[model samples]
Target chain A: MSPESEEMMWCHSCREEYDALDAGTCKECYEEASETEEELKREIEDLKSKVHFLRLSSPIESDLSPSDVSLHASSDRKGVYPPVPAHKIVLMSRSPVFRAMLGGEMEESRSGVIKIEDVSYNVLCSFVQYMYTADTLLNEQLACELLILAEKYQVKHLKFFCERFMTSRISNDNAVTNFAFAHRYNSKNLLESSLALILDNISTLTQREDYKDLVEKDPRLVVEIYEAYLSRQVNTAASVKELQNV
Target chain B: MSPESEEMMWCHSCREEYDALDAGTCKECYEEASETEEELKREIEDLKSKVHFLRLSSPIESDLSPSDVSLHASSDRKGVYPPVPAHKIVLMSRSPVFRAMLGGEMEESRSGVIKIEDVSYNVLCSFVQYMYTADTLLNEQLACELLILAEKYQVKHLKFFCERFMTSRISNDNAVTNFAFAHRYNSKNLLESSLALILDNISTLTQREDYKDLVEKDPRLVVEIYEAYLSRQVNTAASVKELQNV
Candidate 1:
């Protein structure tokens, strides 16, 4: 409309006029970036199709394949649950624990029935389904339970999946509990994030019941938290001192 | 640097100074594009891990799983090649043809051996390997052979893979042959690309030996090519007349 407005450059992306101060990349860079984005999107589509093609129909969802092995989740209060049918090849392929257990001359391999301790029937079903599809719907509780099972059976991908889910769901409310769980399962990512969250809210740490319970159950873990907090405090103080010196 | 040079804007990406005419995007659009690129990259990484998790070791490559089925590729010159061992569930999952044959009371299902006629041993092995892993290395000749097997078995993913490979290798020399092969296999992508290449070099079409052979073997295919070329010519002439009127 105006001479000044006409002189303002328009963004090729958003098509909005902006001053030189608000400039981003040049035309060549912009074209290169756009091409890179398109190439990345194409790669994503190709990989997604490959995942779809490789994914097998879960045996629990279908009875097409005669399952050679069945998993029983042993429950103390409710008695034995119904067996979760799975293929030995699938289980072995997914987990080295299962591979060793099923591939060797073990009694469970001979019987073709595996008795898993301390996991619920629902959790076991989801676990087996993940082995087939590399996918699962996860709430916080399921994430925690599956992480434990994943850690025990050495399913690194599932363990990483659960850890990422748990990390996303981390809050001040469950920071202490998640910290303990992460430590137990050797989830480095979860441990770092949960510890960071706990230290960020260190003043209210002792007031929480879970924090107090963790203090009583595992005083060493509580001490580790304090050590991290103290180390952070020292680093901040030293940085401030250096700033004043400069 | 001169005062005028100092007044020039620098790209955030390449850090090169550019004038108003060379401007790309505003700061907001640039930041958003960067974030989108990062998200796409993260998604690609996630899908790649999922693919790795979902990929099963080919039974032909491993002795871990006791395969319940074997495939014999019947060759006229070499006689019957060694049976390619594969899991029934894998075959059934990958191909509907295999599913129908294995799931029902077919002779192959009853006997646990499938006879694949008119395919070489190497091609059959690669086909079975692809069923397990959703991957195979392909040359032009192998891609053509595998496309035929993939078509017969109705393994759409493998067929698509081979078609994509063949399409990439399409040249003026092979366009006629590939066009016919694509038509026979109902490979729309390969057919379109090969036909485009053929039309681009239509002057030399009848001069090639393959073109002469195609005319003798399938005259209807040659007619279809001429039909496409004539349609394109008509569309061009109409556009030229419209431009002259304008």
Candidate 2:
């Protein structure tokens, strides 16, 4: 090797030689940064262990759940499902709506039997499982159903989880329907994301079936979309004029 | 600057010129490391939010806790203390012992009252609060008391937490007592750490008051310590002999 090339700096991390222009951090800073990374990794491990410790086993994990209360899902199509047992403390702790319902002078509180209307047995079971485990597998349909249930019971954690799931799945096909759903449930994250996707594909908006359904069901949302489009056009024109002046 | 020195590399992190000897990492490696750090930090934040969502507010934090069960600390000095209200589900979820006691046809479950003997009222309250919050302010005295309670109830999470606290505070003076305590409570982490400390200070072992007390209280533990020391000595001697042979 030439003398100049022989004097090239080497990276402690990748163990590769680099030219002067490719330098990253000095030895002291590298050591400090490595320490910081290790500390962060250790913290993540600790938090993971804590989460595992905090998570309760789902009632379905055992035949006898030792539950103090039972729930019946009263569905229109499937009829009254078998009773799902749950702990009162867990129910109350996870949702303020449940706390109020179970703590007050209500028949459900007295009887220890909560009858939830308009939800299928599967949805009800998943919701109760999420209360114990703080986790659930979600598809598009499950996310939609859970978001509504989360909103109804005021379970902010589950609501946020569902909103995040739905936001990631937002696309041209489902944007209109998701936007309407977001507005109905007051899900700000989902609403903003769906609006952005809809606005980006504004030229092809009216052709979609969900768009026609939204317009028929909620014409005010369609008007708001046009207003937003107009506002965007005006802002773009203002920026163009300012640039021309400059 | 000299031409040779002017050719030196500059660190992006510390922003200082460095020679080949002081080189740390290449630019690509540094960027990748930075991204990994950011991802880990984001994960930590997510896990923290989950923990916050899972943590239940202590019933003691409220004037009228919607508690269905109450605990009384039967203290030796003060007799029965004021009832500390708690939820059965919370207790049962945290500890298998509590689960068995509350789930079966136990008198405490039937009466909705549990008597915890051989603990102060303050300690009982703190234990219940920790069950809810997964946190507590700890001193050596409180750590010892809570460790005992955690062991009796088989609350592994709290037991590990107390063991960590006591391990951090292990020193020459407390080594003997801590070793004995760790053994009694089956805290393997604390026991190993305390034993290591005691073995390191074996030359002055008999001079400490706690060491003498341990010898009187449980001479078998002292023999075990000596056995461990002798085993360590034999290993060291073998390694030294192997080196000499080489």
TM-score of 1: 0.96
Q: Clashes in candidate 1: how many?
A: 0
Candidate 2, residues A20-103, lDDT tens digits: the string is 678888898899999999999999988987887777777766633357788888783455457889877778888988888888
What DockQ does every candidate get? Answer: 0.73, 0.58
Worst 10 residues of 1 chain B by lDDT: B1-10
Candidate 2 lDDT by residue in tens digits, B1-246: 565764687888988887777888989989998999999999998889888878877888763336778988888455545788998777888888988898899998889899988888889889999898788899889999999999999998889889999999999888898999999989999999999988898988668888888889899999999999999999999999999999
Q: Is the docking of candidate 1 incorrect, acceptable, medium or high quality?
A: medium
Candidate 1, residues A202-244, lDDT tens digits: the string is 9887799999899889999999999999999999999999999
Model 2 chain B lowest lDDT segment of ten: B59-68
Error of 1 at B20 (Å): 0.6
How far out, in Å, is residue B222 in model 1? 0.5
lDDT score for residue A62 of model 1: 89
Model 2 CA deviation exceeding 4 Å by range: A1-7, A60-66, A76-80, A236-246, B1-6, B63-66, B76-80, B241-246
lDDT of the candidates, in the order given: 0.90, 0.86
